[model samples]
Target: MKTTAPRDQSRFAPDTASNGSVSPKNLLIAVDDSNATTRALQYVGRLLRETPNVSITLFHVLNPMPRELMEHGGSENPDMEHQLGEQLRKDQQEWMHMEETLEYPILERALERLRDTGFPTDRVTLKLGYAGDVVDTILDEVRSGGYGTLVVTRHGPPGAARLFSSSIADRLSRDLSGIALWVIE
Candidate 1:
């Protein structure tokens, strides 16, 4: 695929162009419920906390119930189908609420960690999305947001567990181009 000139702006240290416009100063960091993810955030916090011009976007993807699971099944009573439909709506709402309940704490914890590093809250953005593939979601966010830098954690034990599924870092390194990708240890 044809691509444009690379911004190549480092996530930790943003680069400024001749026109004084910062390239890739907007960083997109993928957040998960893993220590490695936290470490990535901490590493970034330590590096960019003092920079007043950079903006950080904390990104996370939530996995929702499968389509079949959400589908309403057949019912015995004549009105059961309608009731099931109503129940399905209620269930979906509850499911979304529960996701919000769980997601906020994780995002908040990440935000607090960044805040502790002296990163200003005003410059920080919290983004949450629901998708099947985490890596693809992040990549889509990076592309849509026009982020110059993408930050992600290198999940450990890079063998067996990932034998079937590719690691996020690996997929990103292979797919991403013309942008800065930071794989935090």
Candidate 2:
């Protein structure tokens, strides 16, 4: 089923155009297929309904393997390290395969939702990578694609009272400059 939220009714609208003639503002929405991500997407959809000349991009970052595990040798066999490395490679491949299988369906659903809510199709982008490196990847995309705003959902499980802290989002907000960041709860 489709979901939506109310548009912000503030009088002061943010300028979206880099050049004249109402160019579409690229908006990045980070998604993990989590409830928080879905809420964020709905929030963005509502915002788009209120704001003209804007586009939405959906992004999902796969959670990465733990650094500590990678750094320290946990296996007993000498060949265990090599086997683990191979296993990781296999896991990554499987993850990518899963992404490939799931990507189109997810995008199609998102696009449908956005379109139904009056957003344009030419503006959507779907990207996948390690969750730890998502901020960097997003920044790179912003620089390369000229996105003016990023809309991310505050990390919180359903029925939770507080937003959870994400290392990637924290790092991005701290390090990145010259882009508008919106965190939806």
Candidate 3:
């Protein structure tokens, strides 16, 4: 008997390029619902419209796993553990629902927006993932994806909090070396 892995949630755009050779220009765009994210995508749209032979991946990382979903492997009492397991299972279902309904829509809209700007469809790819630390997650993708340019938005409203908020663009910029970091305003 064979078991199959769960289907990947990513929707890779159909490559429209005629030639098989990979484009030398590759960009990884990390997106969210913030205004900053819109700015980043718009910037890419404008850039890609004029520039040819560029490939871009639209990457979105979902919020880290909720505490309720984490499994407790060891329990002194079997009855108590069984109840906990059931609750976790329900939480897992909810998480999957959020992925399908909430998360995928963001990526879909982002893709549609870029396509509307006349960017090549095949040259774009979508990645929906679980984020640990936002900065670390992005760096891992950048390294593994071979992206020459990592494009991310500087999120949050302009204020002192903007400097202190949970925005990871600054951290990413500091941590990233040898890779071009584009922090869209």
Candidate 4:
């Protein structure tokens, strides 16, 4: 699917070339509403203040698989499978609703903080997908969307292992070309 431009681009500084022309740059930020992610966004905002012509994208990955997926095998019974599928859909819907009602407020707060610090709201992009596959999806979007940089957060010493294992950072750094990866503390 084609990625759409974020609605709040006006909050950031306008891009201008050395020759006094427009030169826009795309920035992708992987966020999960964690403190580390917040730090990363702040760091990206600072970088954008220093460097003009950049847009920031805030991406969140939502894993859709349920615990039952691992426990339940692909049974031959169509009825059972259908019931399981329905349950999964219901669970997913509930999760999405909870996120929209609860987590969205937190995300909005973070976005407001960034805006208060001078990052344009229009530059922010939010996306959702499976957490484990976020790296591949982000990379695909980066290539297709023409983003120039990716700003990702790295957890502190104690939580670093979990973050690295779950995060898309390492894969993105290794696989994606022509995009700068910034890992914040």
Candidate 5:
């Protein structure tokens, strides 16, 4: 008996489906000023240093003031509503100013560190977003930004506290199943 090969062999050759097709990996690194965050960034920096077709977005989620607090500014008097409104305006102004000044250093430090570790500066960007819930905010970013992977450091409280309370890492691992997640301890 003689055997015959299929006319269409393109299915078997996966790499040849598209010639010179580059799928750039977009990495979202969720960070704060913590040792674990530093470790995560360092790891990625070293791992991705020589790899081509990779870009990084350093993301920070800032928790905005609660609505209740914003309404009254912690004052009990009803007459202080106007005062609270003024205070709120001042606080918002302060926040914008802080975003202009304070947020730059955080991104700068991370950028410098990544550069030191050999990651290209041109492939990196910084994003700052505000939300009341941290985990939700991160997940939102991952979905909206089309990030290929999420890198976060363990920020759970130490020892006994963690046993009673859930960490952001824990929630993220459970909730963010669609996206690739790399959690550094």
Candidate 6:
């Protein structure tokens, strides 16, 4: 009987890329400012540390205040309505600024963590989307971006757990039938 060293299957394992050429493995990670998002990114970074030709795209979705909030512009009291409209405009501007300034550091931190795990800095990208319906926006990005995998944490922001007890993840998994979804606990 001949005995031989076992081959490393991981090295031979085939990965999914669009074409026959070795395209980078593209991953889209759903992110927020929550600890869950940070943890999920950390997990993914460590897991794919040595993966060749891998790329990661951090995707963030922001929901602006409902249009109804500004509908007070037509209220009976013109002066009061004018004040309310001003306030709403200010609030919208503040949200937009937050989107620009706050999101950058969060993405930078995630990029740093992935870099620490041996992933190349140049292979990472960040994308931002805005819509009233967060799920729809994420799905739209997934379809347009052609990501091979979708990663998200089970819970969202601190207070959202009570309202959406795994609902977002469940809905995303069901809706994204063809795409790969990873819901990290």
Best by TM-score: 3
Model 4 segments more than 4 A misplaced: 1-24, 50-53, 69-87, 99-102, 156-168
In order of TM-score, best first, we have 3, 1, 5, 6, 4, 2
Model 1 agreement with the true structure over 53-140: per-residue lDDT tens digits: 7888777676655685478887888799888888888887777667766776666777887777777777777767566677777777
How close is every model to the real structure, measured as TM-score?
A: 0.72, 0.58, 0.73, 0.64, 0.70, 0.68
Q: Give the least accurate 10-residue stretch of model 6, judged by summed lDDT.
A: 1-10
Q: Indicate the residue-level lDDT of 183 in model 1.
A: 85
All candidates in order of lDDT, best leading: 1, 3, 5, 6, 4, 2
lDDT of model number 6? 0.66
Quick one: best lDDT, which candidate? 1
Worst 10 residues of 1 by lDDT: 1-10
lDDT of each: 0.69, 0.57, 0.68, 0.58, 0.67, 0.66
How many pairs of residues in model 4 come into backbone collision? 5
Task: In model 5, state the lDDT of residue 83.
Answer: 81
Q: Where is model 5 more than 4 Å wrong at Cα?
A: 1-24, 66-69, 72-90, 156-166
Which of 4 and 6 is the better model by lDDT? 6
List the pairs of residues colliding in candidate 5.
none
The sequence of per-residue lDDT tens digits that candidate 2 reaches over residues 1-185 is 22211121122222345552222476666665556666666667766776665656565444454554344444878798788878777776666566555554554555566666655555555554344556776676555555677766667566553222366567768876777887666
lDDT of 5 by residue, 39-144 (tens): 7789999999889967787776654655654554456776687787888888776765565456546656777777888988777777665667788888887776
Error of 3 at 42 (Å): 1.6
Task: Go through the candidates in order and give the C-alpha RMSD of each one to the true structure.
Answer: 9.2, 9.4, 6.4, 6.8, 14.5, 12.2
Count of backbone collisions within predicted model 5: 0
In order, how many clashes per candidate? 0, 0, 2, 5, 0, 0
Q: Write the per-residue lDDT of candidate 6 for residues 28-106, one digit (tens) a residue.
A: 8877767777778779988886788777777666555567654554678888889888987888777666665665566
3 versus 6: better TM-score goes to: 3
Candidate 6 off by > 4 Å:
1-24, 66-95, 157-165
